[model samples]
Target: MAKEFTSLGLRLHADAPHISYVFIKHHKPKEGEAEVPNALYVAGLPLGLDEVSLEAVFSVFGHVANVVLHPSKRSAAVVYESKEDVSQALQHASSGQVVDFPLPAPEGPVGLKAWVASHRAQRPGNAELQKQLDGWMEAHEAAEAAREAARQAAMAEDGWTVVVRSKGRKRAREVGGMSTVSGGIAPAAAAAARAAADAKQAKQAENFYRFQQRDRRRSELMDLRHKFEEGRKRLAALKAARHFRPN
Candidate 1:
């Protein structure tokens, strides 16, 4: 087989590895497997063609449903309302057909000057903005003052000593050997006081109801025993006083 292939000038060298050829038949379309209707792939479109202009040109033949333009490829895919509209467009529309149509009006600012004017019209003046910022700062400061006053009143009511920190970044000297006291009690001391109060309250409540129940039970048992003893003595006296006894 290698020599026969070499004689035919097919194989470059004799005694080469056997080569296998596998043939695949062309794919045939099944029944009713036609391309979709009412859509057409249109080529040779003008470079400047936009979706709106393309639609306008195609709409003259029939009602165009949609027009998608590919500017780089200079082509468009147009879908019409019906297959008949696509057929009509293909029959009539050729090069230079439907050349004159009304162009759409410009939707936005056309030039750099118009854009700059629009932008300036939308922005607020510097003086107006500064005044607004000053008003906002004044309001914010007033709100802070009111909050601080309310906080001080609340701290005083709660028996917390208010210790004001030194102003202007000076290190304030500690009073009464306290390491740090900014607004009220130091966080560590406050936490210890709260924990001690909570423990005392829990100790007072622990087993309180159970003690009452035990005391009430003891009192009831004592009363029952005293009643039984008194009844026994009275019955003994009645038995001793009996005049006649049945055998």
Candidate 2:
């Protein structure tokens, strides 16, 4: 059977963190009904987690209905069949421990559908919006560059020294140590390393900034395309209704 969203009593608030109240109704087997109960609602969790681990942890209490992970938000939704199962799951669902990440605690009942809708509605679509996104991306890139420079400078100041392991040996085995360079690092090597570090940082920043820009553009284009399609469908429906009107 298809999953029902209405079964979860989800209350959506504009200014607060999303939350939802889930209530599962128990019913006896009529005739050849499945022994396990069906899950009514699921809560979304933060991203970067292994599905197998979550399943293993939650399954200890009751059967898991669905666990949907969102890539962008880095969150997931886990649905349980019975209220008793939910209670059990809640006991083990400690933030940043069981899942190896901090889970956002919802204030009250929340609807995932509504939250998605709100994000869609608030998304930028126009040329001005694109310009703003580009500006933000550029600013982020610049800030990242400054941070990289600072990190490299700090590393250079706190030089890496080579320490000999033994006193008598044909070739001494040098171990890495963080000690001040008496004569300072070779100017050429230090400059080259700094340049290399800067180049690497710039490349990484550019790649990340470009990726974000591409995703934003793609989302905007898709939203516009969907809206256009909906308008066309509405127009076609109106035309068909008018043509088929009884005289």
Candidate 3:
């Protein structure tokens, strides 16, 4: 710290109870220049005061180069283009009364009255909202149509003919000398189905052969029984007619 200071006013509130002043005193002449040139430390700035307003306030004395405000501390450091403006500001600060600076009207409407008027003006009418909704729906339908066209183009590249059905879901079949549908039965599944059918036919043939053999054996047994029964009857008749001799 080179021990250099400058005077500036503290405008904390309009009727602040006490007033404080900071005076710049130089004890000894230093060989080099000051650490910060043409700068004044300002305190007691009102909250919500922007840099533009601060600059405008200080620019009356000189061209304000920059203003760094600390809202929490309610203080700001103002840098002037030349040292003469610093001297002028310091002279103004030496007066006991606060500087009378004109605060510009706020950029936009503020407070409850202005806010209510702005809100009412900005509110959208029912007709406007409905028109916006209609525009959005139209855009959405156009986008869907574009996407469908692109999808059909891509499918046509792969030799597929898509059939769109109104009642059910859309299906695509292979065309241009292609045998199968795009998403139909796979080759492995087809092979498995053929194998199952062949196995079923083989089982039916085997069962038929087994049934023929069983039927033939049953018919032979029935014929032998019939012949045996007829021979017994004939022997009985012969015994009755005395044409049988015992040996």
Question: Ranking under lDDT, best-scoring first?
Answer: 3, 1, 2
**Model 1 misplacement above 4 A:** 1-58, 66-78, 83-94, 98-143, 166-247
**Count of clashing pairs, candidate 2:** 13
**167: Cα error in model 3, Å:** 5.3
Give a tens-digit lDDT track for model 3, residues 191-213: 89999999999877864877787
Lowest lDDT 10-mer window, candidate 1?
4-13
TM for every model, in the order presented, reads 0.31, 0.21, 0.37
lDDT of 3: 0.68
How would you order the candidates by TM-score, starting with the best?
3, 1, 2
TM-score of 3: 0.37
For lDDT, candidate 2 versus 3, the one ahead is: 3
lDDT tens digits by residue: candidate 2, 61-87: 688767655454333445676667865
What's the number of clashes in each of the models? 0, 13, 0
RMSD score of candidate 3 (Å):
19.8
Candidate 1 lDDT by residue in tens digits, 33-70? 76557876665443344788768766776888888676
TM-score attained by model 1:
0.31
Candidate models: Cα lDDT each: 0.60, 0.54, 0.68
